[model samples]
Target: MKPLEGLLVLDFSQFLAGPSAALRLGDMGARVIKIERPGTGELNRQLSIKNQMVDGDSMLFHTINRGKESYAANLKDSEDAASVKALIAQADVLIENFRPGTMEKLGFGYDAVKELNSGIVYATVTGYGQEGPWRDKPGQDLLIQSLSGLAWLNGNADQPPVPFGLAVADMFAGAHLVQGILACLVRRGRTGQGGRVEVSLLESALDLQFEVLTTHLNDGGELPQRSAVNNAHAYLGAPYGIYETKNGYLALAMGSVIRLGELLACEALAAYQDPKSWFTQRDEIKQILVDHLQTRTTDEWLQILEPADYWCADVLTWKRLFAHDGFKALGMVQDVGREDGARRLRTTRCPIRINGERLFDTNAAPKVGEHNASIEQEFKLRDAQPSVGQHQPDGGERI
Candidate 1:
């Protein structure tokens, strides 16, 4: 059985971060139900990547929301609010990414929720923390990256504040939320008292930069210098970036510059014998690599580097990586849906493996309120309107 086999998660948040946390819980066998607006559903339902839509919703939505049910309700509507409150009372977890005070205004804040379901783990995601000047700003990935100084760390030195091509802030925030939620679940298992988990995009983005930020904080507040040439990491020195070869690209990790010089027969690198020069003259050293690495093909460089146990790899695009035996062996991709697997959308499976067993769910994401009737019947939601200020037992009682 999965670790979260019997848990119920109400995903009240839209977009990547909060939905992703709920997705992880669903992967671990929690019964996740997205609480979305009636008719329109989630904002992400129309937020498409490459304008791709699947089964009437964005493929992006399907990617994050697969294997979950949806319950459509307008919180402003009294009957809908009452039903949702009833659901919250029985949920093992409740996740929301509304702006500060929005939940309170809707009567689902931590204090209000605690009264109905004392053991429900409440998770909130925001642009920033609850109390801050940035609390009201949009909780977007790029905005968080830009605001948290993450964008400065990407690309070469000459590039202007380049944000990550991926939604790194959202992804990291979701991962952190999962960590906090799981930790709370562990604590709830012990004390029988559920807790609140608050993760913000800005905070998670800063946490992502902890290593470089720590160096900056203790090293006399020195700002990180991005490498002028082929900068892979803002803090790393030479040979820590991807280089172009005669054919493909090769990624070289941190290693002895002298040893690399001897192996590549590029005598210029031998002049920088002092390890300190690796950082002090990072651009000059990387320039030498840029000029020399392209002298041979990526495969030629890999042939030489691999035998020496050097930290190097031939960079491959998704097409090449997917076809390679190394990628095929991990079985990273899976088709999800009820119909013939060949016809369904292909996506990545849960990365987590328990007892060496991979977690694979084939169910597709639900349409708006697809499971509403069944959920109403099962939970008897129509008759579960608790009185205002009603309090459940302090201990968690999963129904």
Candidate 2:
């Protein structure tokens, strides 16, 4: 049996944060009912690139919403709301990402749901929080990065702040939601009562940068301004960045002060042997290393460094990483065939492994209302089906 075998989750969340959390629960064998809208379902369905659906599937939607049963319903309809309440009555958990107070206004908030199912664990994934100054304000991942001081620490010191390549805020919030839900589940097991758990994108962003935030708080130091715009480890000291080799690049992470002497072993890098010289004259040491690295190919450096246990690696692109032996050994990549007779479907698998076995199988993202009939039959909800409301002409206002 899976970890959360008998638990049922009513996922009334859209986009990334809450959906990702719900997917994690689903991975652990929770029965996830993804509550989407009547027409297009999740907003991610329209975020296609160049008129092409990413990955021959809904890329954004699939990443965080796999292994879920879709239930398309317009919550604004009173009858639909009643049907949702019925689902909630039998659910072990309810996860939502609506703007603060929106759920309460619709009469299906934590209080309302808990009244019916006292043991329900309600998780709220918001941008700011439920009752802050920005509670009702609409926020995206970009805004949360700025608010959490992450943007300040990114990019070059002289240039404008840079947005991260990934939706770090949303991803972090999802992780926090998973942690909160697990903790709440344990609490419920002990007390026989459910609890409310809140995870905010802003809070998650801040939490991910705990090292930077805590250092600033304790030392009254300002967040680090990046000297190198594209470098991954911007805050760290010298010898911890990408250096151009004869062909492509090699990344070095020998930045630990204690490891400085060990990393500067090359004859060309002998000048940095003096601890004071290395500490005070980082530019000089960096230039020497850069010059030496430029003489050798990345492969040559890898051959030398791989055996030495130095924090070094040849910089690899996506294609290289996909075919990497390390990931292959870990079973991080898997093949999936489609009914359309596609050549190949190489997809990344879930990371969690228990006793050397994968925790869950690859469950593809469902089509709109794919399992509606099955769910209705299983829960005897066919008789309780809601009359989903129609969208209005004036931008479809919520009820």
Candidate 3:
């Protein structure tokens, strides 16, 4: 049996961070029920990556939200809020990523939910922690990366700040939330009590740079100095960046500059025999290697350096990586189909294995409110009564 086979998760979150955590739980065999608005559902359905759409929803939504059931309800409506509260009473876990006070206003905050289900694992994701000046700022990935000082670490020294090409802040926060939730689940298994987990995009981004950031903090308050040419890491020394060869690029990791010069037969690199000069004169050493490497093809360099056990590789684009035997051996891709079997989308599978077997699931994301009737019947939520003073201006009722 899967680790989380009997657990139930209520995902009241949209977009990347919280849903991605729920996706990982589902991969481990949890039953996830996504609670969305009645008409528009989660806003992520409309948040497209590269304007790619599939089956009337964004491909980004379909990929992260696959293998889950959707229940539609207007949270402002007293009757719908009552139904959700009843469902919460039976759920093993609850995840939400609304702005800090939104859930508390709806009466589904950790303190409120703990009263309804004491053993529930409640997790929250936000742009920042509850009491910071930057808490109210939008929790977008790019904005968080900029605010966290991560953008300054990339690119050459002369270039403007460069944010990661992917939504790193959101994904990292989701992974961190999952770590906390799993830890709490372990404690609940022993203590018979639930706990709260909170993660913010800004915190996650900062944690991602702990190594370099720690160095910066202790090194006399000096800012990181990015290499003026071919900078891969802000703090690493010479021969630690990608270089353009005759036909393509080659990446060189930390290695002996003298040995590299010997292998490539570039006499100029031989002069920097002193190890300390590798860092102090990194730019000069890199410029010499760059000019020399351009004369040979990437394959030629690899042919010479690889057999000698040098730390180097020929850079591969997505097309080249997919076509390689190494990528195919991992079996990382899978096909998922909708309930009606009328549509299918190929996407990446969960990167995990249990008992020597890779986890695989074929279910696709549910359409808005697709499972409302069935869930209401199963949980007997329709018969639940709204608490006093639960009514609000919006159709939704307070918890």
Candidate 4:
């Protein structure tokens, strides 16, 4: 059994950050019930990647919302609101990503929620924090990256600032939210008192740059200098970037340039024997590597580098990586589909492992309000009164 097998999580959030946190708890074996709207449901049901959809919902939504139940309600309506409040009383955790004041306006703020269920782990995700000038700004991943100076850290120095191809702001913020929620849950387990977990894309973005930001803070407030040639990290030195080879690309991490020179037979790299020059003349050193690496194929370089304990690897495309046995060995992918087996989505599985067992769930995402009838029947929500909720753990090997 999974660690969260006894828990009930009410997901009142949409899109990536908040929803992904709920998704994680579900993966850990929580019975996650998504509180969506009546008709259109959450906004992400239509938010598509490559305009891809399966079974009338976006593949993006399928990937994130898989293995969860959905319960649709119009929170503005009194009957629906009261029914939801009943569910809230039963929930071990509650999550939302509405703007700062929205939850309070809806009478579901932390203060109000804790009154009903003092043990509820209230988790919130925002673009910015509740009290800030930027709080009202749309909590978008790109905007967070741009505003947080995260975008300024990518690409070659001459090139424009590049936001990550993936939604790092959303994913990291979600991961951080999970960390906080799990911590609060552990505390509640011991103390029988819950806590609030607040994470913002802006804060998570800044935290992602903690290493480089520390340098900026301590090194006389100097901004990062992106390498003019093949910049990988703004704060890193020579041979720290992905270089093109005869066939493909090779990534070299922090290593002795002299050793690399001897291995790859690039004599030019030997000149910068001074360790400090690795940073000072980084552009020149990198440029030398840029030109010399292309003379040999990536595999050829790997052949020379690997035997001598040099830190290097061949950069592979998704196609090559997926075809590799290394990727196959991880068992990272799984298929989830509807009950009828009419549709199936091949997506990534939960990354966590416990007691040497990998977690796998074949449960697919439910349609909007798909489980409402059953949930109402089980919880007796149609005529819910002010009653204490039940939480029974199907005994588990804690993860």
> Candidate 1 clash total?
0
lDDT of each: 0.88, 0.73, 0.89, 0.89
| Cα lDDT tens digits for candidate 4, 1-399 | 887888889999999999999999999889999999998999999999999999999999998899899999998888998889888887888999998889899888998888777778899999999886898999999999999998889988899998999999999999999999999887777667778999999999999999999989999988889998989998888889999999999999999888889998988888989989999999999989989999989999999999999998878899999999999999999989999776898999999997889989898888999999999998888886534423322221132
Off by over 4 Å in 2: 54-57, 223-225, 228-235, 255-268, 273-280, 335-346, 382-399
Whole-model lDDT, model 1: 0.88
Q: Taking the tens digit of each residue's C-alpha lDDT, what string does model 3 give over 1-399?
A: 887887889999999999999999999888899999988899999999899988888999999999999999888898898999888887778999999999999988998888777778899999998987888888899999898998989899999999999999999999999999888888777766778999999999999999999999999999989999899898899999999999999999999999999999999998999999998899999999899999999999999999999999889999999999999999999999898875799999999999988999899888999999999998899886433222111101110
Q: Which candidate comes out best when scored by TM-score? A: 4
User: Model 3 segments beyond 4 Å from truth?
Assistant: 384-399
Task: Give a tens-digit lDDT track for model 2, residues 1-399.
Answer: 667777888898988899988988887778889988886888876665456464444666666676688987778987666667667767778899999888898888887777777777899998888786898677699888887777777655566777788899998899899999888788777666677999899888988988767767786665454544234444565676678999999888754433543544466555555556544555556666677777878988888777768788888898998698875677776654433444434466667875667864556676677777777677666466432222111101100
What ordering of candidates by TM-score runs from best to worst?
A: 4, 1, 3, 2
For all predicted structures, in order, the TM-scores are: 0.96, 0.86, 0.95, 0.97
Lowest-sum lDDT 10-residue window in model 2: 390-399
In model 2, how large is the Cα lDDT of residue 233?
46
What TM-score does model 4 achieve against the real structure?
Answer: 0.97
Q: Work out how many backbone clashes candidate 2 has.
A: 0
Kindly provide the TM-score of model 3 when superposed on the true structure, using C-alpha atoms.
Answer: 0.95
